[model samples]
Target chain A: MNPTVNNLAFSTTFNAAGARYRGIVLSANVGIMRDLAFNASYNIQSAAYIGIPQDILLQNTNLLDGGQITGIPLRQGTAGLSYQQRSGFAARIDTTYVGSNNSWNRNPFWFANASVSQTSGRVSVGLGVYNLVNSAAQQYGLIGAGVFVPQNYYGGGAFGGPTSAIQPGTEEYGLPFRQYWLTTKVSI
Target chain B: MYHNHGYLLSDDFASAKNDVGFGYTWLHQANTNGQFPYILCNGNTQNVFGTYPPLSLATASYFARDTWMPNDKFSAFATVWVQRSLNTISTHFDPRLSLVFRPTTNDVIRLTSGRAYSEPDPSLLTPAPPSYGSPTSVNCPSTTTGSGALVAIASEADPNLLPETANDVELAYGHRFNFSTSIQADAYQSWENQALLSGNVPISSIAQITVPQHLIAINIFSA
Candidate 1:
């Protein structure tokens, strides 16, 4: 029995001249009243690129072929509404959604924001709250080589048993939590 | 490290029914210095560093565009691009066309079609360092060995690869009502050829590796 599972991970650049992509976008805007407005847009696409690894030992290429490319979400969209009062006051709310791809099954997230302001003479003061929903969102998916665990590679029984899986990369959750901001602007 | 220098000249003219502009650009790019780990298989105590070969590439482009509106209801825009890359002794010609029609003050229809060329990254054009033999030293003992020797893979680089090409078309419609509500939709299709991506190919030689294709991998076995 081979006692070694020293797998090496390396990547090289090549020309995938056959990659193709297509998509559609839709957007709408409406003014509910003289001071209130809403806008939204959605995008959907199907992008295909060839980059899956082919195991030479197995002599099989179709196992991972035709899989969707990583990092590109199949569906994404955003919606927002804003209202402005003649008295120098305003409020707004927004939501965003992003679908998943081959690299990961993403969770949809939404956040809201609101602000109020008062203007006197040449000065204005405002208070705003961002990410009112405090939704935790991840920005990037894991698509690079991930860490390897010994137990996962070789089952507890023997070397030929089913091998567990390891994530090839990690995700980045860069969205900030709910926060508030205060501002004072002076006209020059 | 990379360095770039470019210059552009353009002119614009307007007529009763058309707007025309033309421009020429000249650019030179150079990749002067870089070094990276060439090969570092697991349990290999020594990592090999390879030096990058300096590269000087030149590019030139000539472009012209015209926007014509014969009447208030319809308009058209046409553009042509002629680009040359010195590294590859060839030139590319691309054309783009767009048309728009406004049936009413609140409705519009648009169509666009174009072809474009993109050059590969500068590093992709340089050849990788030659593959090295098995390392002379080992830090850890393995549990198995393969064919009484260590087998490794090396990436083969090609300097002669050409630029990728893409074609795209789009159709769009928009409508507005009461001057307060508007809806816009667009459908597009794009295809690209000569896309650049890494692939793997089996190695048939023992003491040496061939070039122009394949990826790098190192397999270490223990005893």
Candidate 2:
């Protein structure tokens, strides 16, 4: 058999395209008491491609394969309550819920944040806590061979076959499970 | 006809406050060469390699606005905008109307409606054509195996993309309970068409391995 006769090659390309995003956001803020206030918001979004190549296999039925448009969470929400006093004291606790998103096979996760601050004349001191739950979530990933070189025509080193293994595309990870920091500000 | 405030109709027209303004805006993309740099496996550019696309384009818009306030109780405002671009929809017209009504010292109502258009991203407006490279076998430094074979890849650009447009209307009401407390509520609805996004395209395996075949590939790069 002639190696040149059976040479089979494959490549990938992108085109300027269009997609649709439809959704509604509802938010509310209310006073629980003279010194306490509560606020929350919820967003519901549906996205689809106006025009997609019909040949590509659909990885996600709920979302358009190429049109899924990464980084957009279908459902996400945050709620928080705050308390303040005239004597220069304030505190707040808030929780965020990120619905399961397919941007990079990321699962749903919830995290809470809290902060306390006190102000005296020209100085203010505060402390904050992030990712109270400490959940390890993957925010994004790449779908292709795992190598980091120029291979095949697409740009990265080639994998064993057409269906290459998926790998992490970025250095971004889910919010740190639990982290704390202290902050102080002075205005003179 | 006689006026209730003892003012003639001509006097009312003369006393109304009126204002007019005109403005111009220009946006240009600094790069137009539409060149994508890719790494070549060997001396031959046809061998498999890496690539990145750069973008370039420009647009301009002109607008005029007019406001008429006959009295403190009510006012009317209108604006018209015309935008020109290099996209498929080269020209677009957008207009807006606003009405304000004050029934009491602490109560106010506002109604607004408008049509707006957003051009596609400059990067997406002009895409470089796809390139081809021949498969070459090479040694692998990272993998346990001593050698590997590189495959072919291709990309496609769309020049016929359209701009996104929306029609919106909103109603708002505000009331003041006291000097330090107030509440505001607004409800709005918008309809949009031709929104832009990234999607996968179908291409043949031959197109990727062959030399310079126009093909569309699945977007494997992540953000």
Candidate 3:
């Protein structure tokens, strides 16, 4: 007599995998005027996995292509300018850029921020706005249900599986939209 | 002949010229709700329960440093730091040494080395195993001849996980061009062990399964 058993399982665990990152950073600060200063910086980076196959697949069936490590952006840069007046008033503007790279998919984004504050005696107040342009860009990606489901549903065509069966895929998303706020600081 | 200031109350000893200092610091953190309660699953959608343990853990660290200046151009310093945790990991000891040399008024050089360690996250230290729902069998329709099935998967935590550790060496040089601007350069190399990551383990298998659906569970560990 012959006996047969069927079992399937999916699990995620942590391993001591290795990765390498190399990059260069350039920054400068210039005194545009007596009370005004300008600063800028640029960062360029390249990251790759070590001791792992370039095409290795994760538990979610997503391929780790190009030896790309997760959560590391290849290129990013920032520039800002600040001005301070003798009357205890200061204002600054900053902008940032993130080059497109793959977490799971390509994510390129940009945003700007500005603030103005006035100090009188012991109290300081300011107003600021984030995501000045309100650009819609995906900042992160993941593999999961309802987020990025790699599945197709049919009425038991060939395998006679339920319609809820899932395929393999990834999903991408960005951070919150533009926001504005006010702040106050008191010196003790 | 020597001159004495009122900075010291007792200066009779010859070693009294050396500086002595003492410092103490304390930190207390409490785990609260909404801090880390859920794990992100799939892509962006769907949240899995059981990310953190019900209990709370606290950690404390202390450090002391001493500096000795034998001459006007050179100084050496050493520090010892110790840390202890309540529930995550055992105590850790770290020692560091640094030497600074000033060859000229415009140039300064420093060499330093240290060992550092960090405990794992509370959630990862005590992880909630993934819970897969019951599996259901699907019968082949009139067109197909075989059957299929589906299941959900989750991950488990490792209790024997160790804290991450690293040994680092650094060399720094600084030169003053003028009072308003200066140039500094640093180079460092580090060797790290017991790094944490996620991996998949096959808990079960399926055979003769035409259309088998798998729910993979993952485990956390330090390597």
List per-candidate RMSD values in Å: 9.5, 13.1, 12.6
lDDT per residue (tens digit) for residues A1-188 in model 2:
12231122223323323455555666666777788888787776665455544332221112244343445677888899999999999999998878755333455667788999999999999999887666653344334422222122222322433333443232234554478989999998
Report, for every candidate in turn, its global Cα lDDT versus the true structure.
0.64, 0.56, 0.54
Lowest-sum lDDT 10-residue window in model 2 chain B:
B1-10
Under CAPRI classification, how is model 1 graded?
acceptable
* Candidate 3 structure quality by residue, lDDT tens digits, B28-142: 4444232222432332222333322233445566667677788878888887777666555577778888999999998899999988876665555454434443334422123
Looking at model 3, give its docking quality level.
incorrect
**How high is the TM-score of chain A in model 3?**
0.69
TM-scores, one per candidate:
0.64, 0.56, 0.62
Error of 1 at A26 (Å): 1.0
lDDT of 1: 0.64
Interface DockQ per candidate = 0.26, 0.12, 0.18
The residue-by-residue lDDT of candidate 3 on A1-188, one tens digit each, is: 11112223334334354444455565556667787877777676665444433212322222242344555677778888899998889999898877765343435677788899999999999999887777653445444322332212221333443345233233555655677889999999
Candidate 3 error regions (>4 Å): A1-15, A18-26, A44-68, A100-109, A135-170, B1-28, B34-55, B60-64, B71-73, B82-88, B101-109, B127-152, B173-185, B203-223
Identify the runs in model 2 with alpha carbons over 4 angstroms from their true place.
Answer: A1-25, A32-36, A44-76, A83-91, A99-109, A115-129, A135-176, A179-188, B1-17, B28-57, B69-76, B86-89, B101-110, B129-156, B172-186, B204-223
Q: Of models 1 and 3, which has the larger TM-score?
A: 1
